[model samples]
Target: MEDEAPVIYGLEFQARALAAQAGETDQIRFIVGTQSLRQENQVHHIDFDDENNVINKNVFMHREGEMWHISASTVDKSLLTTCYNKTSESKAEMRAALWRLPGDFDDVQSEDQSSHQSLSLVCHLDATDYGDMKSVMWHPTGDNSNVVGLADNHIVVWDIDTSGNSAQMTSSAGLESKGQPKLTCSSWDPHHNCVQIATANDTFIRGWDLRTMQQTYVIENAHGQLVRDVDFNPNKQYYIVSCGDDCKVKFWDIRNVGEPLKVLSDHSHWVWSVRYNRFHDQLVLSSSSDSRVILNNIVSLSSEPYGNLIENDEDDDDDADDRESREASPPQDGVIATYEEHEDSVYTVDWSTADPWVFASLSYDGRLVINRVPRAEKYKILL
Candidate 1:
């Protein structure tokens, strides 16, 4: 098979928020939000046809504010949450809310990209009493009944009633220390049926139990500087990954938080996002403020460490010229591949729920690139 070039799509305004459209297997889809202070912010529904290498999009006007972060429901395709920057009386405030697409977000041909339909308001995930909202997380595998939001100084949990189009604040926990400690990002613990969650508060990483809304575990100084993002290993129950301003991606076992299982100092600037491949946890991805995305194979610590391995090892007997070439820059398997299609800071990278081999990355300049696992790497895992 020939190598396919990445399908590129551009948005009107600068953006940093992106989410993979959930619960669909037949199509590759994602939602991207725009950030503009003077112009109306927009939410774009993007669809990629892998066979033909085409990108289709639908645009909707969001009159609220500049989007800070966005998340999609695993159950409802049209339902999503956005943490936005709303300015009132010359004061900028970050807020989060639940909104619904006008109709048929998956159907690209249903409406033209210039329809300019206003987003339907579902309900307000009001965290005003708490503080500025950072991000919202939905249950990975459960129904769309409960959602978690990271506010300035609190992890606010809410129960959504779609029938009434309203959300009720169920529980919230304060996270403050000597000085003001702001919550940066969060991840839902996929282990134990998603009962726990971890939040990056200041430079410390803390876990909380959803049932009691209390702290469960703490990894003090998990990163040398501020931690940007955290993600739970989907296949392994205890293993998790984190990246931060230290420009390093570290893996940890929450059970033993004293030290990290492994660390990779691959990015030159702040590592903004890290995600383990949904099906193959060994395949890891990390995007950085240095405007690069690195794909790594952390085999030894993966769920299937010994099985279907040795793809890179098979090439060890190559000629001396090949060895010299590899020393300068290696192949896609174990040597890792750095994607540099964006000119701005690449903030978010995600694996496609529909196709395990396909993934998407969004940069701050509103460049969305749809890429796939290297064919050699893909065949190595399957064969």
Candidate 2:
């Protein structure tokens, strides 16, 4: 007989973007949004163990604004918090703040067991230049000195290290098509040597090389409807994945931008976000407006051995048949799991960088759920 595998635990919250600490696998953080009646928003940090027990919990930030987007710094374990105050029907102000863990912070226990310390505000910038900020991201490399923000019709880059008082917007890029709808989402390309960004606007995904301050590549009508989110594969340089209002996920190779490498249509409603598993190259997760989170296995669909047909000189007719067979083969995406716990539309889903099995999902109804991938090996042993 074999012992039972450990059962994973989940914690729920009222938040938007849930980010795991850079080097700490057990630490997770997120920010709550302001309610329509002007209730205050907050940032939360939680520490959990392998068995899903909550070790420590703290409120990192408490303020009077709505957090539109939040990103955790990969290099320094800090957080980039972006928020806005809607003053009137058509007037709003946006701000970005950097928060860091205090030096005397303890993962074990504090002298005051009843009190928890808040995260220290390193610096913050308030600007009226960019209104209605939609997304924010930290540069993957360069010691995380650079941050990017996307707003109505422009993108702004900030230099946190060089600026003495607070992070300053160093440069700005305006959308080529000015009158179109504001940018929907933006992602930093992890594999590019320099700073390269991919942004979704309406039905197109545009790639920008920040080094040259130019648009490098653009995919026209990347989706049937408005593109919601775009993410690049961390393992492969030119590979990208995007989700859109059409309830479809599309994959693209930047080198060949004419068509998507594959299109995955599984979600029944608008797919809001898509993420690639950091540890497993084959796994991708998406959250949709249908109140479900889906896990997809795309290794067979994207790998060359399964997607491409072999050619042989011995049989010309066989080679032609093989080509036809390859063209007729459907996408090899398999839905391994579906999570339907959230009562509202799930807006965000993120995978933990340190833990392979742990992930988090958040919904518009102020519900957040932490989940673990079910493993059969943990439950049974083969004899």
Error of 2 at 40 (Å): 2.3
At residue 55, candidate 2 shows an lDDT of 39
Q: How many pairs of residues collide in model 2?
A: 0
What is the RMSD of candidate 1? 4.6
Best by lDDT: 1
The digit string of per-residue lDDT tens for model 1 on 150-204 reads 9997999999987799999999998757676899999998878788999997678
State TM-scores per candidate.
Answer: 0.92, 0.81
Q: Candidate 2: which stretches are off by over 4 Å?
A: 1-14, 23-37, 52-56, 86-90, 102-119, 142-144, 162-165, 301-332, 376-383
How much does each candidate deviate from the true structure in C-alpha RMSD?
A: 4.6, 6.6
